[model samples]
Target: MTGVLTDGPASTRSPARFVAFGGAAAVLLTVVMVGSLDLHRLTTTAVGLRRTISEYALGPYRWVFDTAVVLLAAGSLAILAVLVRKGITRWASGGSLAFIAWSVGLTLVVVFPKHDWSVGPSMSGSIHRVASLVAFISLPIAALLLARPWLRDAVWGAHARRTFRFGLLSALSFTPILYAVLVNVLVGTSWWRVLPLGYIERLLVLVEVVSVLVVAVWAIAAAQPSYRRSNTSR
Candidate 1:
């Protein structure tokens, strides 16, 4: 197995890469699992769960999710920053940095505190809808920016195409999930009961899981010196 960051003679994968990858994986997994729980049901359930595990679990969960979001944004930004400094795909790096900043700000200001189980006109219900859209959309944007060269010229061109396709799908999947979360928040209806809501939720979950995993693998591959050298040469 190759190092996570080193490509040719003098490259080494930073521990930060591993941390970022792990955080990304957690973010993806947590979104799927928690997202799958019927929001309306979970909200209603939080009423009771709060008395039991909600309070105990709330702080840790919030911290973990919040930290993961920040880490992901930061990680992506760091990669883009390096690329920009190195004069590789400066435009893409700039755009990725902007998106990462936006994502972090949105999460902190809009989504973090809302994760609380508090009742009465709280935004927690809609937070997932908003955050998921931002998270999924920003990721592919960064991925495209970071992986543009590899995507464009690799002999296995299908890899880049798949990455783009998955990114688009992940971004698009948020629509239904967002709608489902919104409907639950606004109307008190169960998203699962709807004809395709359950299926949509599952599909979104699958897409997120697979997308994150693919990106993690891609990140590792990209960090490889040989991979970078080949793409740059192409």
Candidate 2:
């Protein structure tokens, strides 16, 4: 199979590839820098703050995460768009872009604010709850779309199968990490909350960080036209 799938000669780059790689790289770097911050101390302090002020202060943090999420979604969409332009997988690529757009809206309006630890029964809270639920349900939908032959084959063939496989795995792994962050760290409503939610959150975050790095590397490698053409030919 390896011999049957030898890559082609190198060629010039596409602007879309550059956009995808640069965006992914920027996201990875931002995540690394943010991960280095003393979130433990920050979260602890925010948790202790009188809920109102904590809510206000968390806005900036939420914005930062929202920005990162937007960049990642854009980068991924750019990759898909490039593939589609090359006649790789029109439907799958389009669906993926739609999913990203939906997810971005949900992340900003719902999931992002939930990290506040201060928002209560307000307009924002309602929007957050609705959006979060939508986001959660959309995850499986996005996963299915991603796994579809058109999208998966295009990406996997163009970028190294191993790289594409890892990207899918990274997306899947987000399920567990998201669960931990939401049920354990964010809510803290159950006896399970008595357990060390902090540790779980951190561990999951580490996984997410690693996943983004893998994606960034894949994006960079996939930018080469030779890589794209080889995979598409197969």
Highest-TM-score candidate: 2
Clashes of each: 6, 1
Against the hidden true structure, what lDDT does model 1 obtain? 0.49
lDDT of candidate 1 over 1-234, digit per residue (tens)? 111223247545655445545645554655554443435346655442222111222554545445544554454444444334333345445445644644564455334343444554356645644555565556656555445555655343454556667767766876775676678889988754433544564565467546545555554444434433323432
Q: For candidate 1, which ten residues in a row score worst on lDDT?
A: 48-57
Error of 2 at 183 (Å): 9.8
Where does candidate 2 have its weakest 10-residue lDDT segment?
48-57
Task: Quote the positional error of residue 58 for candidate 1 in Å.
Answer: 5.2
Which residue pairs of candidate 1 clash? 5-13, 6-11, 6-225, 7-224, 7-225, 7-226
Across 63-167, the per-residue lDDT of candidate 2 in tens digits comes to 555555555455555555544544434544544554465446544552435443344455666566556445434434443444344334534543344434544
